[model samples]
Target: MLGFIESVFLVLTITEFILGNLVNGFIVSINGGHWFKSKKISLSDFIITSLALFRIFLLWIIFIDNLIIVFSYHTHDSGIMMQLIDIFWTFTSHFNIWLISCLSVFYCLKIASFSHPSFLWLKWRASRVVVGMLWGALLFSCVCTMSLMNEFKIYSALTRSEDSPNMTEYSRLKRQEYNLMHVLGNLWKIPSLTVSLIAYFLLLLSLGKHRQQMQQYSIGSRDQSTEAHKRAMRIIFSFLLFFLLYFLSFLILASSRFLPETKIARLIGVVITMSYLVGDSLILIFCNNKLKQTFVAMLPCECGYPQPASKGPFAS
Candidate 1:
């Protein structure tokens, strides 16, 4: 007796889960193989590998959470299962977001041009800076993940204590706990979102300026480099846009959590939010020549190569 909400959730979950796993799994496997053979990888490959791994875990947690909500709500609400699910969800999700911000920063460093002294310095030491940022992101995600777990624990306790006989003391404790939870949930996200937006803006500005310069010397058709630049910008913009949408979706889902009647909003929010991982990975494959080539190479082909099309009906 699956209702509309459950049906929709299942459809989106199955489609996104399969697509996300395939794309991310491909990225991870190819990069992993390269790493093994070369004994190292480029910074971009490292970041992609790390991101794909995080995404795979995040998608799994999302699937399990959705399955529990739709099929085993009674079991999920009781005892320690909810807490464990919350922990893994918060950790994997936050880590995925942080890594994406790191990717944005890396792209800015690699692609954008700035005349400021600090920008010049960063550009000079971009590799080291990116490495340090990745480590910092990992550490920060761990701290934030633990903070989320604590906030949830405190919240459960606060709910129970709301039945206490002392009204004033309960009010004070409730206010303190509410504020702590608010800060804990938002502290990491605000900074990461800000950094992501800043990177997006700077990259856009740099590309715009570059495009203007290229236009000055253009005579006929668009050159290969200009087209490439546009393609890169488009890819970045698509990824950033999806990230922003995912952020908003998560916010809606979080706010809707308290409103028991807003089932539709929560369901839609989860579906849209999960789409980001799949969409972002698709963008990476589309934008990067190497990844696109690798994916094409992996596709099954007759005689290990694409065959020319025939005019007949049963052409293979």
Candidate 2:
């Protein structure tokens, strides 16, 4: 289940995303494409797009690490590989959450009304600095969490336990460490989710206001408005689905640990995290019409699938 073969598939996923972004990266360099034809391509758009690409790249790394861990479970019980595995495990999990948070922030910026004027100075500025700050925020949080991480002794047999002979009375701090780490890890999620909800509400109100005018406008404009609404709806629905499933799983996880009585609750927690991670790409792709087209086009043209090319909502 784990070996060079699985590693290859992991590489495939990363390569696929890298290729996808590079194709889109053209939108940034040598005349950024019509991805945002409705508005001028400014530094913000460039940064947002770049951040989106970076987030996907992070996901690829996390997936590849998971595959490596899967392989290690069956391969030789080692010293070097074990240390690498532990570091990868901590890094992937922490960075994954941070990247997702950044994505959510970028999406909010894209949909919100712009107030800043597009100046050449701003447009030509560096985007990497902003991205680095976002990542730094996540890195800080992850580092803070290390202080609270629960520790258990690992043996050459690939087994870990707090109750093992190696875990002496002096080392018993599982309950305290678990609670601290869990709380710190989930703390950022609250503000991220809150911002999303507030932004969504404002978005709904704005959409509602546009609806009345959409009826009075000319046929061409009205059709455009209608299409825009549809696109907004797709994004909103995707966000809602993600929030519902993710929050439910988070609640179960917290409850299980806090209550310490419901064994099923812990299992449900694992299921939720797994489902959310695997489905993250699907959620993003399905929410954006243009992204979906890119996906279909990357597949063999011989299949003749109906990959709808989109720029704006009304792109036909």
Candidate 3:
């Protein structure tokens, strides 16, 4: 039987899974529908759509892995299944994070008022640049997946040699192997995190510079360009906040292996990670004008309830 904490974690994971899928699905459908009719999509929309699509798969992979872990006692051949799950999880997660980083880069190039020759040159070729980044991300994921599979093979071989004479030594070695695998699993995320942080700081710097220029030109009135900078800043800031939380939760969950009592900490980590999946999508929907409009229109109107006015800083 599952413990109380485990039961709660299960429920929360399911709730977030469902909510994350809905918001991500909404993003895909809206952008997809527009593309189908128009036969084209903006580079930013294309990236967002692809990111949402990968996130849907990533969420399913995560949910399935969680279920397997929770019920491993009742299951046979779980190790092989887990190995397969890890492969898919790694690929999907890599795509998700790298795409987000690409989005940040896209935002910086498109919106940031930079006059540097290199920045202007990249902005002019933004679509090709993002495509190249996506391909590079795919190549990197392939390498990481191959490395993980190799590790899994070695670990499986160790497990299969359980009849060895040095049982104590085997146990210690197994523990060490497990720890090494854990670290290897998480190490791939660091590059993506670094890229995202760099893009975020660049956006921040651009926003600051843009604001300074606006202050000098304006006569106590905000202009459209100023509002654009603010909106972009908000979106990127939210992404940075959620991405950092997600990364931190992974670290906490990884540390749970060394702690004597880890159920609570592990559960907390899982919850926060799931929150990032759901919360980031919600922020994107609310902050993007088309998404917000479509989301509000989809809600059923009540006779007496006041509909939210569309006039806000978020409005495009």
Candidate number of the best TM-score: 3
Overall lDDT per candidate, in order of appearance:
0.73, 0.48, 0.77
| Candidate 1 lDDT for residue 10 | 88
**Which digits, one per residue and each the tens of the lDDT, describe model 1 over residues 128-240?**
98899888887888887777666666667766776666666875677586545643474467777777788878877876777787678774336444454455466657766
- lDDT minimum window of 10 residues, candidate 2: 149-158
Q: Candidate 2: where are CA atoms >4 Å away?
A: 1-98, 104-108, 114-184, 216-222, 250-267, 297-310, 313-316
**99-133 per-residue lDDT for model 2 (tens digits):** 44444444434443333564223323324433764
TM-score of 2: 0.52
167: Cα error in model 3, Å: 4.0
TM-scores for the candidates: 0.82, 0.52, 0.88
Which whole-number lDDT from 0 to 100 does residue 278 have in model 3? 87
Q: Per-residue alpha-carbon lDDT of model 3 for 1-316, expressed as tens digits?
A: 8988788889999999999999999999998999999998777788888988888888887788667656663442236786787689778877788888888877777777788898899989987998899899889888877777667776676676565666777767886787667665777888988877777777778777877776787744366655666777778788888988988887777677677866566667777877888898888788777787788778887234344444433442
lDDT of 1: 0.73
TM-score of model number 3: 0.88
